[model samples]
Target: MRAVRPGSARDRPATPTVPGLLAARASADPSGVALTVHDIGSLTFEEWARRSDAAALGLIDRGLRPGDRVGLVFGENEWIDYAIAYCAAQKAGGVAVPLPAALPAGELRRLLAHSSAACLVHGEGRNPPHTGLWTATLAELRPGAGSLDDVRVRPGDAAQILYTSGTTGEPKGVVASHANLTFGCTADPRRRPLAHSRHFLHAFPIGTNAAQTMLVNALDARPGALTLPRFTAARFARLIEAYRVGTVFVVPSMAIELLNAGVREKYDLSSVLLLGSTAAALAPSVAMALTAAFPRATIVNYYTSTEAAPAQTTMVFDPARPDSVGRPASGGSLMISDGEGPVPPGTPGEVWLRSPAEPRGYDRDGDAPGKVFRDGWVRMGDIGHLDEDGYLYLLDRESDIVKSGAFKISTLRVEAALHEHPAVADVAVFGVPHPVMGSAVAAAVVRRSEVSTVELRAFLTGRLAGHELPTRWLVLPSLPKNTAGKVLKRELRTLLATPEGDDAAHSS
Candidate 1:
């Protein structure tokens, strides 16, 4: 092991404070056009700063306490508004909680309830429905008088609590401190382009990890960079073509949609220099597809949980060795351990990381926030193993794996097989109960049209090891997906909790 050089951090120039982050960008090139939104609008560093200051002053004067949670709700095409809210929250020493615009009233209410949010600064019409129980819209919230000057924030303080996509039940507030944001970003050598780069796109929502990463990148490298109001495959292509976007980041789902949407060829995207992918594992095929689309750009695959430090691992694409998630960045250490013991090379185990940055822990009781790490390392709930070369290869989730008799099965393997089926769109696999087989592999598949379990089973027979194949296949119009597009296998397991849950239940 390299024992992670503390010297590597020193090699980089002294990083400035959070406020300096924005100011440095403004000072570097005020009219440099920090941000651009194709067909929407653009913002200079001066404009972004002015709005940030206004929102900060507004948030402070509006009685927002330091560390208070301010819900920043924006509709599509309001990236500037979201940025304003984020900077303002930082200025006021408060945290910005970005809520997805698509969530319904009930789900929105649950988010507010869970967040214990006392104040909200939201755009009109963009406020999540039924959030009135707690959230307040921004336009309607007039400054209460003089609340600034009192909202100074320290480097170690948390800047936000980005909620997970709520694919399971509720989202957990993965915490990130200001320094954590700064350190995590600059540590990754991958961001060297961002050090003194051109304007980048923040097309995704402010609430998502992608947006958060973009925010830090903006503040750290080129301040006042532009971001799209929202992300759409067509709009993404247009933005890149028009703005000469140097970097474009998105999930495989969006990338696939863009490819299939026929817009990829419609735009002159030569300006796209880096294609960054994160959130969930991008199918290897999707990685290949991205390389094919952005021939001029470097395809970077980043791995981090809402719970871990950003860019903990990153792999720039090389078709010859395309599967790695890159080496650990300068800030953290990564290892695969069996909870108590270290695993051998190529053996899948839980991915654990240790970062000087990242939340010490979460606020479990709504007070006295706690750190979630043990000793120094944090448990990242992902199941992957390091190869002899230190490249990480992901297996299915440890809990999501299906154990049938003596063989342990990979749910992802089965899902990948189902995805290859002509009629299947998406699917979730699990192990329920079995008297004889110990546990039987079960599947819930979302199909395109009339498809039967027998047909699906027949489809998988030769493709999957007989024991690895799902015993039964149930068809549905769609499988449940959380905001981040992760499948809610936990929900499926509960819903199918009966032998019905295990149509492939062990032969009693």
Candidate 2:
């Protein structure tokens, strides 16, 4: 068996965490602008440093200490406040736990209970209605305070406990190290780490791992980076033109919203360059749509997760192969293997990655540290395979795979096929209970026009392989999605709530 991956680990350097990099960038560009919000005044690195210092000092004055976990519960654009909380936590030796703003109150209560966070810092009006707890806004933390000088912090120390939607349908927190965060943040150039990036835009509040990864990009180019507090597709288009924003991270859904909102042409987006797309796989059709809109930008699709942020893969780069999540980052490693061993070329298996990009571990699953975090491999429970030239192709999450009559079907493949149908607007595929085959393939879809099960099945007939088509169809106004926009198969499967025949005869 191949042990630790060659590149992601070999490349990790002394002081290979994020806080150190923040310190270095601040020193080199102290007088430079470091942060901003749309129409709001920007801050210089010196100012960011001072604000972060004051924020940290205020937290300390409130009795925060190193090693304590503080919840960073804020909206996407105002993550700078979270960053201040994060940096302050680092200065005082504490971990910042960033939680998504969308979790229902019930879920938030459970997660906060699990995280054991002592306090939280959010922008005004962004705090969760935690019912029983007292929350403080950044504005309320201190009226005016001076910045503190650099406070030493060590690498390999726990930095953030980033929560993710867990496999069992629970929200699990993944612990990321300063080493992992810093090393991965600086891995890309078009998306490099700078004290000042030309311009930045975030459509939501900073909570999920998606925003965390983007924050790394903004902080690297500090003082110059600015964000919108909420997603106003029209307003965002104007801000990009007004600020000459160059880099943006958006989900496919948000891209759809922007196009639907009719904002791209109203503003000059020519200045924007790096347009990164993730959180979910992009449809080739959607990619083409995006490509046409941002003719000057490369719409990059990458393989990533909450457990392992991003890495190289067991795939061959072939842009013509529209189904793939692009080539691996410059220095990353991956292997596709059936449960027992490595797979041969073209065969599918659970995709495993080994890199410094892997989150150190999760809050509850010590197994993630012991089994997944080997000398460095992270076993992301995603099913996929590699092509001949070394590129990764994701099939689906293991839990999302549909097994019927001895055949395993990837719902993502089915969704991709359905995406091409003219009337289909959105679709989600999952397994429904079946008395005959243990499970049956099912799909829930949103459509532009009323579509019958027969018409949809007829459409799928020519587009999909025999065993790869859905066994049942349900037309929904819209598929259910989590705050992050991931299709909630569990929710759909519940709505499906009954068995269906696994007979291939029913397939289109």
Candidate 3:
């Protein structure tokens, strides 16, 4: 297949639909590399567009209708197929529901049932859950001489339903319109986002908000997108060297692992021009280490949620205000409220972000949307205060604060102090039941070198208040994390609640 030369086409899609984005890119540069999964194959814009069109035709033949939900279950190694299937769903005017391969069978069933998906499209060599829905493999979607010209997909039509990581509760399906997914896309390659790089890389798992953003980046950004089947500091570093990748995206957990494993010293990572951390706030210490590791790269931390996509705060790591997550980005607005109304700077309150793109919400019935979405703003469920200069500083998740007697301790503050220790590799702080204090602070720490709880407490004695220091400690091999890389504090709470001297009890 030959690629069309850039600037050869003058007519571009007027509306930014998912299928429209691909059509525009293919028309502009059909031969340009669109996506690559390392050690796996890649597809050019032309191949992606053609194959997805064929698959869309197959879906239409199988009785898929506009507004029908199609569940897409794909394995990590099947990104190429996943991309085609995703586009095909949109092209066929169906709502795509992407699910990660690592999801448990029961949870997968729950999501498919919740979405009321009409069919399931799965990758090769995988067993889709027994959902009683019509199912087919990617290979079964054969290419054919067919056209989707009659399909009536619109920018405002529902395009996909993505489930959250369920860090706090059962995952909620988030609905995004074609416009929401393709917001800010540009037809001009020279003016496209992330134009500084030839290629950008990430290891975010599929079925996540971060991964969905990467998919949109693949569709809208100037650079070709790259990912690995799995993430390890070694392989991630090697890809940077191999591709000389300019822009890299990661979560705080990945950044911590890279620093702990000393991958920066072992690999040539200077090719990275911009390093972005998302999913969770980067601990100040970790952010500083990343800056030192990627000496030439601008370390940026992005703050947003599933409901607040395309609306986030971008911080280019500033040592003076290391804890800030930056101000509301262009086309977005940030406000801190104390339930009744907006609060003054330096006063911690619930965080709300207003989206520049169309608002997204829980794809369920009843009061769910009202609980999180109000007017056009999304409740971030986080407690933070803005500095006088307008930079936002997160104190803790509303659910993560430890209530000890009369004091409300920020778990983030404790974790940040613990991270300052030379021997501390990683740490998570949460509240555990205490008859006297109601909830006492408990800490689970992963050590790089031998370090006692007594030492850790001593280290925090000056850095934290007496009530803020952890009374219970557990030295852990590693912190538990969901696929999205957010620490599973609920699991840690269960572990900490175990009786002392029990086989499973590591608490001191």
Off by over 4 Å in 2: 1-13, 39-41, 125-135, 140-151, 184-197, 259-269, 310-319, 357-359, 368-371, 449-452, 498-508
* Candidate 2 global lDDT: 0.68
TM-score of 3: 0.95
Give the per-residue lDDT digits (tens) of candidate 3, residues 229-271. Answer: 9999999999999999999999999999999989888999999
Q: Write the per-residue lDDT of candidate 2 for residues 1-508, one digit (tens) a residue.
A: 3333212232345545565666666777777665676655566656666676667777767776666777767666555666676676676667888777666788777777788887766667774666454567776666234333434456657778887765346666777777777765442235554323366666645667777776665556432666777776787787778877777768766776665555666777877666767777777776776666776776777667777765543222235888887556747778787766689868988887766453456675455324455556677778888889767788888888888889888888898888777677777788888899888788887776666768888888998887777877777776776666667777776666644423212333
TM-score per prediction, in order, is: 0.80, 0.85, 0.95
Instruction: Give the number of the best model, judged by TM-score.
Output: 3
lDDT of 1 by residue, 56-147 (tens): 76666666677787777776566656666777777777877777777677766777667777676777666356555445454454455665
lDDT of 3 at 434: 94
Clashes of each: 14, 25, 1
Give the lowest summed-lDDT range of ten residues in model 3: 1-10
Error of 1 at 40 (Å): 3.7
Best model per lDDT: 3
CA shift of 232, model 3, Å: 0.3
